[model samples]
Target: MTDPSDAVEADRALKDKHRTMWALGDYPALASRLIPELGTVLVRACGVKGGQRVLDIAAGSGNASIPAAQAGAHVVASDLTPELMETGRRLAGEAGVDLEWREADAEALPFGDGVFDIVMSCLGVMFAPHHQAAADELVRVCRPGGTIGLINWTPQGFVGQMFATMKPFMPPPPPGVQPPPLWGTEAHVRELLGDRVTDVEARTRMLRVDRFARPEEFREFFKACYGPTVAVYQHIADRPEQVADLDAELAALADRNLRDGGMDWEYLLLTARRAGQAATGPE
Candidate 1:
């Protein structure tokens, strides 16, 4: 068995690496273009209403946060990357929405228990090094009877397949670390939330990426703006053969999902309500 201390250290290292990967490239430019519709969907699913306290954990570029705020919720957008948070600030301003942007980690949110009426994450939180810790934090800060909404990329989806394709070029994850896509499955979500929540529901949605003209162009766009893709490109920069292989694989994957001049990216939308207060005088 791995030493407990070593495991902790490994997790810390992994989180640092994740932060670096996300911090690289201009994620907001891509997020602003691709995530607004999904953000609207998640806000609706969470039942966010005027005057409600909403927290968007790992909110990339304020996509969900701006919508929730626009709908009249008192929104707080949190992320680990300062650059991303700044991007969100600018986006919120541009949209004429007000939001409280905070630099926070998903595994360790800096909020009081039962504070928020709704907790939501968009293609975020699942990237945390400790899945259960992140899940617990989401529930802990949410008031009883409040909703938790999430959008995650499914393992069998195009993005997941792309990540798998790049796995050969990247280092293996630490032992016992779960892939972020696990949050996309109903069974895993159930396990993560356990008995802490009720009315758990999950549905798959197809999000389209249509900015590029061709599969090769799509791959190149990601390489320029998506951090993970940029990291992969940088890693294999010296290996021409490996670079060619990566490009070929990504182009093929993108082509398989292409339709109407865009690619269909499938993701899971999850919603659940925290168990409410028990009746003091039961029947």
Candidate 2:
């Protein structure tokens, strides 16, 4: 029989590994420069107001958290990687905004039931290995009738295709770890959140990413700046031929996707209200 303590220890070890992986690349820069609009959009859509308590889970460098705070809401920016959260804290300070920053895991958030008015994540939380556990937590900490906002890359989107392309060269995921892009699908999220939420509204939006000057630039930049892309390359670093092959593949992908001086990545923006106050844990 499996010991409960062993399961707890295993999850902790996995989280530690994830923390290291996220801190490996220049994610804060990407979040700030390219997708900063996403955070603002989500905050506005959720109607974040002054005096509301907000939680930004998996908030890498406080994307959603900072904007919500700027809107006068009390925001807590929580993430697994302290290094990433530290960058957000510094940015918030410079922007003359204050946010409570905490190191946290999405599957097991360190907050009580129904403690927040709005819980949001921007291109975050979807990365949690255990999707159901994370989804339950999102519903758990939110007050009944409060909001939950999310932005995730769709499976048919450029970013999703990039991950699919990279999968062949990457290491196998641990058991029970779901693909992050699944969160972007409407039905998938609806199923995950289940009946614990109401007023479910989700829509796909196109985010034209014009960050790269040239098609090849996309591949090179991701290899250096994106944690997942960087990790994949690092894993195959010893295999020069494999690295060369992956380089060509990624460049080709960028070339195919790039147009009108940019690439269009699709994302889903979802909002729902928490339901029963007692439906915090999964059955």
Candidate 3:
């Protein structure tokens, strides 16, 4: 077994790699094509109202943050990637929505306790190296009786399966690092937020992607824009056999999930209220 200190160091290094991976590519180019509407759905579901303090943690390019701010909420968007945050700022400005953008780690948020009325993330915080730490921070930053909204790719969903397909080519995750897809499961969500929140609810949604004539085209699109996929493609670039194997697997997975010549990316949406006295405010 790896020594405890060694494991800590390994995880820290991995976190750095994650930050670099996100910063490497233009994620907004991909994020904008998919899941923009989901942000609006999440904000509406969380019941964000004018003047309520809202936080979008692990917010990538201000997808949810822009909509929340447009709804008149006092929105602050936080993410680990400065590049993504900059993109978010530009988008917010274009939308005529004023927002405070902060470069923050999901595991250790730079915010006070109960500082926000609604804390939200869309397919973002689940990528943190420490799942429990990220979950705790989400709960910590939200006031009691305030809402927490999340959109995660379920383990059995298209995106999760895509990650699984790439597993053979990618290096194993560090010990003690939980699979991000666990956040998509109701049982795991209940366990993660144990006794800290009430009225926890979940629902599934299908996010459709336009179909590609060839799987190689699909692979190229992700490798060009999606950080994790790009990392794996680069990691296996020297090995032709592994590359062929990955391409085959990805093609098969994509074909299986195809709906009317398009791809159906299914995900889970979870919303819960932190346990405490409800605050009377605009929301």
Q: Which lDDT tens digits does candidate 2 get at residues 92-157? A: 999999989998999999999999989999999999999999999999999998999999999999
Ten-residue region with minimum lDDT total, candidate 3: 211-220
> For residues 173-224, could you state the per-residue lDDT of candidate 3 as single tens digits?
7777888888888898889899999999899888878746666667777878
Q: How do the candidates rank by TM-score, highest first?
A: 2, 3, 1
TM-score of each: 0.93, 0.96, 0.95
Error (Å) of candidate 2 at residue 228 is: 0.7
lDDT of 1 by residue, 130-156 (tens): 789999999999888888999999999
- Superior by lDDT: candidate 2 or candidate 3: 2
> Candidate 3: which stretches are off by over 4 Å?
1-9, 211-213
What lDDT does candidate 2 reach at residue 198? 95
- For candidate 1, the lDDT comes to 0.87
What is the descending lDDT order?
A: 2, 3, 1
lDDT of each: 0.87, 0.91, 0.88
Query: CA lDDT of 153 in candidate 2?
Result: 97
Candidate 3's TM-score: 0.95
